[model samples]
Target: MRNVSRCGVVMLSVILSAGLASPAAAKEPSSEPEHVGVLDAAVESLTGDVYAEPSRWRPLSLGTLFTEGWDQAWASPTRGSGGAPRQGWIGAANGVFYRLGLAAYSYAHDVGDNGDEHAGTLTLYTPFSRRFELRHDIPFVVNNKGSGNSYHTNVGDFSIAPRVILSESQDFTQSFG
Candidate 1:
């Protein structure tokens, strides 16, 4: 688990460094104002392209992983397709239509004997309209402990989050649940 965490950190650092180095390599001046950071610049570049030409945008698909056809499931919702920009303090929704996410976490503890814990969460987000969205999370957990190496597995608490977009603008977006 520690090694995995370390690897993730290293990968993130490499990606950020690469983005930061690109601006310096270009050297040419741009018409747009400078951004505060590489992440900010990247975000602006992506959102600008996405918002500017909605028709050109292609939905991401999983190639029949969850659906029968090539473009049936996992298609990104169009920006103006009955939902807001999908951006706010929560995070970029990437698509306003629907989204599915899976995340895993692991940890080692030394309380009495060396123990390890792992958890995986599956989340689904669906936007009903411009102002409202529903999110559900299901989690599973595993624990291993003691010299006997006993293992315990169980389902964690499931949760639902309802989000509302209060305000949105070119500068920022605000939302709450």
Candidate 2:
């Protein structure tokens, strides 16, 4: 996360310096602007207009946060790339993601062992990137067979899988990892 912020700052600075380093305007008599750092509000004014009109396929109330958000979700071949509205469900190529859900878990044992167990469970999916998704499950424990503080909890082991998009088509998509 710290790396992401540092990279963003560097990128933004490069864009601002390049965009604002151009020659001054000839007709600049708009009542001396206030000083804001080095270039007043001039730099801000120029950068604010970077985005064009929203694509017809999708409109955004806000920018996609860390490249994780919804897209048009339709597999179309006509859409372009880069700041253009997506035309398919392949929304993000590389970014962190999280999914929270629930499940019903069941278990049974022999006559000499524990009888049976049925409980709700919480499933959390944490992705380091689009290529690798990790899942941790927490079961609702009615009992823990007299274990310690940590073992007495309802926590379960994690299941991790590295994923990749194997193929994409106008009709469908495939992934493997």
Top lDDT prediction, candidate number: 1
Prediction RMSDs, each to the true structure: 20.3, 20.1
Whole-structure CA lDDT of model 2: 0.37
Off by over 4 Å in 2: 1-100, 107-114, 126-132, 140-154
Q: Per-residue alpha-carbon lDDT of model 2 for 1-177, expressed as tens digits?
A: 999999999999999887776544443334322223323232332232212321211211223322321211111122334434323222243222233244656554522353444345665544332223345555555434332322233555445455433333223334443
Write one digit per residue (lDDT tens) for candidate 1, span 1-177: 999999999999999999999988797444323323434433333333324333333332234223321221122224444565543233445223344455656676654565666667677665443334567877867556635677667888999888654543333434566
Candidate no. 1 TM-score = 0.42
**Shift in Å, residue 111, candidate 2:** 7.2
Q: Which residue segments of model 1 deviate by more than 4 Å?
A: 1-98, 107-114, 144-149
* Global CA lDDT computed for model 1: 0.50
